[model samples]
Target: VYADNDPIVLVHAQTLLNSSAEGRTAYIRADVNEPDTILRSPGLIETLDLTKPVALSLNALMHFVTDAQDAHGIVRRLMGALPSGSALALSHCTPDFDPQTWQKVTDIYHRAGTPVRFRDKAAVADFFTGLDLIEPGIVVGHRWRPSAEDGGAAGEDGGAAGEDGGAAGEDGPAPSDADVSLWVGVGIKP
Candidate 1:
């Protein structure tokens, strides 16, 4: 399932429909703010199995939600609806290091009809509430379990980058300068 405030749902629905030949597909045009609109819709409730393990992704999207909407609260509500073993994968823009740049980015979004609320590392961690984080807890996107394909300074271990680049721990995969500003993590429900 996918949710977005924009009307691009039709485009994504069409793409999925065109790609899927053996499986069934459905699209619900709704905003994340009003999850009940999709949850309570006819056929949707009966179609998806809430008991099964599901991956809820919030990739580059949560920043659009402001504090008034209770972004973290909304995530908690969605996670609570799913049964145990459900996983949440999220990638959020962080302002932990460069506040000035982040502020400018936020301002740009403000002018473009959408408000961007970039959170720091700790603030982003708060969204995972009661879930168990997988290894390499809360690091830059590219630094999370990097593969050989990612060209960068490799450490003695298979992880990306090295101690000189700021990723120090055994599992710490040093991130490129640009990637050092973003925060990404995955958590599994118990």
Candidate 2:
């Protein structure tokens, strides 16, 4: 469920569908605020199986939601509807490190008509209150168990292993175990 109010994305989706004769794809023109409308849509309902475990991905979207809307509440509502064993994959921008740069980026979004509300590590963790975190726990995007070939430490830097060879402290401790612009984690409903 890719919810974006971008006309260009919709246009591209349409083109992809038209070009792919063997595969099946459909695009819904709506906003994330109206989740019920999306769930009731004929195509969405038919394509997704609510009874099975589904991966709810909210990458780079939560920051757009404000306090009044309760971004965490929105996530809980969607998770409640999914069956046990469902997984949630999320990545969100935070202000823990490089507050100045974060603010600049946020201001840019605001000027573009899509204002962003950044959260800290704790606030971001609240969104996954009821789910069980996967191994290595919640960490930055890159530190979440990278491939051995990547040649980087696992988990956020600066704790113990990071003392030897890791990114400098100017960026504040790599957030979790990776070097990413935001926090990322995967959780499973049990």
Candidate 3:
């Protein structure tokens, strides 16, 4: 099951909801802060088994939630619902590398009425406090298994600079840490 608060996301997700006979897909319009509402969603309950491990992916999402929203608490509550061995795969924007640029970005987001907060490394680490962090711990998004050979962190998506071994400008000179201020990590519930 996929959950997103945006109706537009749900609209886009609708086209991809067609699962093969051997599979299943469900999308719920739910907010991240409201963990209980999301946990009790019919679409989620129908699609996922609470008894089994579930991978909760929150890529490029937490940045939209501000400190006042208790972003870390939301993560804990969501992960708390899953059985042990469940994993949380997350990536968040950070201001550690280029604070001035990120401040401008934050202002832009705020002007547009979207809550935004760029946390430092330690603050981001707090999200995985109770869980066991996987190897590489927290790092720049591209540095996570970055390789030109693997197409990972190689392109605009999240590849290392020039590591993709692609033609000139193919990956666009590799994304700098400041350009892609995203921090990514995975942790398993104990």
Candidate 4:
């Protein structure tokens, strides 16, 4: 299932998914804040079995939702609608590592009218309340379950930037706190 508030994005995603498979894919032009729209979408109902476990992934999407929008509440509501065994996989931007730098980035996003709220580890973890956190709980986006081909500095292969990875340029080595500015995790609803 694919959904987006932008009609164009929904159409585009639908086109791509429809081409790959028929009748197995559905795209809904809806907003995440409105849990009912997504949960009650006829297209989604036809494609996904609501009674079964569903894996909901929200990657780099929550930051776009500000406090005024009650981002956390919206997430909780969405998850509450799913089955007990449903899973939530998410990655959120955080300013815990380098507040100064992340603040600048947040300011830039605000200037562009797309305000981003960089939450700390604790704040991000709050979204997973009542759910059983998977292995590696909430950690830097790159540090969560790193793989051999991982592109971040935490990767066993020395990362994509060739050892001197991360935003600190060579001053601070890879796998540093400041380098990983996003928290990632997966949780299952009890």
Q: Which numbered prediction scores highest in lDDT against the true structure?
A: 3
lDDT of 2 by residue, 1-190 (tens): 4545689998887766542455445577777666666667776676667898988888888898887777887888778888999998988988776788788888898899986788888888898899998866666565566543444444344122453333334446433432355778889999
**lDDT accuracy of residue 61 in candidate 3:** 89
- The TM-score that candidate 3 achieves is 0.87
Which residue pairs does candidate 3 place in steric collision?
A: 148-163, 148-164, 153-158, 153-159, 153-160, 154-159, 161-174
Model 1 residue 150 lDDT score: 51
lDDT string, candidate 4, 40-151, tens digits: 9998998888899999999999988888999899999999989999999999988897999998998898889887788998989999999999876887765666544443
**Local error of candidate 1 at 90, Å?**
0.6
Instruction: At residue 16, give the lDDT of candidate 3.
Output: 78
Stretches of candidate 3 off by over 4 Å are 148-173
Q: What is the C-alpha lDDT of each candidate?
A: 0.75, 0.72, 0.84, 0.80
Q: How does residue 88 of candidate 4 score in lDDT?
A: 96
Candidate 1 — which pairs collide? none
Across 1-190, the per-residue lDDT of candidate 1 in tens digits comes to 6555567767866576532456545566777777677667654565567779887888888888888988998898888888899999998998777788888888988999887789988889998989999877777776677655554544443346654344444454554545467788899999
Can you give the lDDT of residue 3 in candidate 4? 82
The C-alpha local distance difference test score for the whole of candidate 1 amounts to: 0.75
* Model 4 alpha-carbon drift over 4 Å, by segment: 19-23, 148-175
